[model samples]
Target chain A: MTERKREILASSQSVLKEKGYAATSVRDIAKALEMEPASLYSHFKNKEDILKITCFDMADKFELAVREVNDIYFNAEEKLRLAIKLHVEILTQNLDSAIIFIRDWRNLTGTALEQFLTKRNAYEKGFREIVQTGIDEGVFNETDKKFAALTILSSVNWIVEWYKVDGKLNAEQIADKLSNFILSGLKKEMI
Target chain B: MTERKREILASSQSVLKEKGYAATSVRDIAKALEMEPASLYSHFKNKEDILKITCFDMADKFELAVREVNDIYFNAEEKLRLAIKLHVEILTQNLDSAIIFIRDWRNLTGTALEQFLTKRNAYEKGFREIVQTGIDEGVFNETDKKFAALTILSSVNWIVEWYKVDGKLNAEQIADKLSNFILSGLKKEMI
Candidate 1:
């Protein structure tokens, strides 16, 4: 995307995060950018178009992050630690887009919604597999892998809701502390 | 509240969950109940009134649950277990109100919003105190009490997003598995 289009997407994300998807309009995006609504129309088809792009972009980031960790030669424990760090970094650095991705994706309709859910489920499946690998390798305890993945993801995904740029703990600190807390539950008992 | 008023509140919560606070109208709630908007006006001054009540009522449920747990003689570990079960039960049993309480509370304005957040913070603080008690008793590991509390709350609270009434796990099952996972993380190293 061009610099101007990137700017529009950023502003649109901010407005969507504030007013929410159903209530936000193209005009609201335009107003946030101090541009004409017609100008925004020329750049993007409509509000849903912007939302689709935003949600898909976030999904792509998560997919890429996990794929990178998967390609590495780390064990399940290390892979999960890196995954948690990457997830927290993406959410904290892209707060507006993260919030919209989490809260406003329900607003997408038609093929967009279907595809979004598919991508999301696939992403979750990838995360669950990591937990499964840990159990298979006799590193993590044997438990419900689906429940474990969801527990880990939900714990980290929720950081977008309460993360502050100026908070006491930065993204790395949160990722470290949270990873320890979650991994403690998943790891096998020490003899 | 009268039976009629209670019915209105229930229907209003469903509408709010579907269309969101910004997009929902008083007419929508009336239509959901097959009543006229004029009739809704008799019970609710406006849409915000219904929202305020829904949010506060959910808060009251949580406060009561924690207060009951706090009044009991259970140790910190058992107290935390009961708290998790009660929290999950409230969310699953009252899914609509839980969703509205978690997501739509942001739409509240002025004094209502302030009071809602204050109550919410207090609730979080109470949860943290339980973790602190465990740490004080050396039952839980020495870690950031605030972070540990938020992690536990976030894991369970996110259940509202994916909980299925007919899903594989019932509320009690989820509460059991989630409590086990979270407590494992919080508990100190067992010799």
Candidate 2:
């Protein structure tokens, strides 16, 4: 992408984060960029086009984060901790796009919506498998793996809603604290 | 509220859940109720008024749930479990209002927004107190109490996004499993 195109996408994400996908218009994105609405058309097709790119880009980052963890040699407990840290880091680093990815993807239509959901489910499935591996290996508790995975993801995914760049804790500190809390829950009692 | 007013609020919540607070119009709420837009004026002053009621009503349910849990004589662990169950039940039962509560509150303006946020923070504070009590009593682990509370609440709150009325687990079962996971994380190791 050109510098101008990247600037437009970033501006669109900021507007979408505040006004949401359903309420945001091409004009609003242009206004955020201080450009004419017609100018946006030269860079992108329309509002949904921008949303699609923003959502997919954020999703790609999450996918890559998990894939990198899976490539490493670690126990499920360590893998889960690293995954949580990477997930939280991605969310905090790209706060605006992360918010759009979580809240506004439902506004995508047709093939775009279908494909987004597919990628999302697969991403969740990947997380679930980590929990399953832990349970199978007797590292984590013998709880419902699906529920455990969803609960863990929900706990971390919600960081986007409340994380502050200027908050007392930076992303790494927040991640460290959160991972400690979550790992305690998933790990079986030590003998 | 009269039967008609109740119907209007319910319809408003449904429409708000779908179109969101920023995009939803009075006419949309009216259309959802199969009534004329002017008729809605008799019940709600405007779209924001409807949103305020929906948000506060949901917030009241949450507040009341925590209060009830606090009133009981159970230990902190059991109290947290029951609180989780009650919260999950409220969200699953009033899915539309809960969705509006979670996703659309940012659109509330002025005093309504301030009041809503106050209630929200207080509600979180109440949950945090439960964890604080646990730690004080040497029950929960000596982790960061605030992070523990936020993690537990976020884990439960995200239920509104994925919970299906006809999903495999009922609200009670979900609460049971989730409370186990959460409490396990919070509780210190038993000798």
- For candidate 1, what's the TM-score of chain A, rounded to 2 decimals? 0.96
User: Residue-wise lDDT of candidate 1 within B48-151, one digit each (tens)?
Assistant: 89889999999989988987887797889999999999999999999999999988888888999999998888888879888888988999999877778888
Cα lDDT listed for each candidate: 0.89, 0.86
Using lDDT as the measure, which candidate wins? 1
* Model 2: CAPRI class: medium
Candidate 2: residue B99 Cα off by (Å): 1.2
Q: Report, to 2 decimal places, the DockQ of model 2.
A: 0.70
> Residue A147 lDDT in model 2?
75
Cand. 1 Cα-lDDT: 0.89
Which 10-residue window of candidate 2 chain A scores lowest in summed lDDT?
A143-152
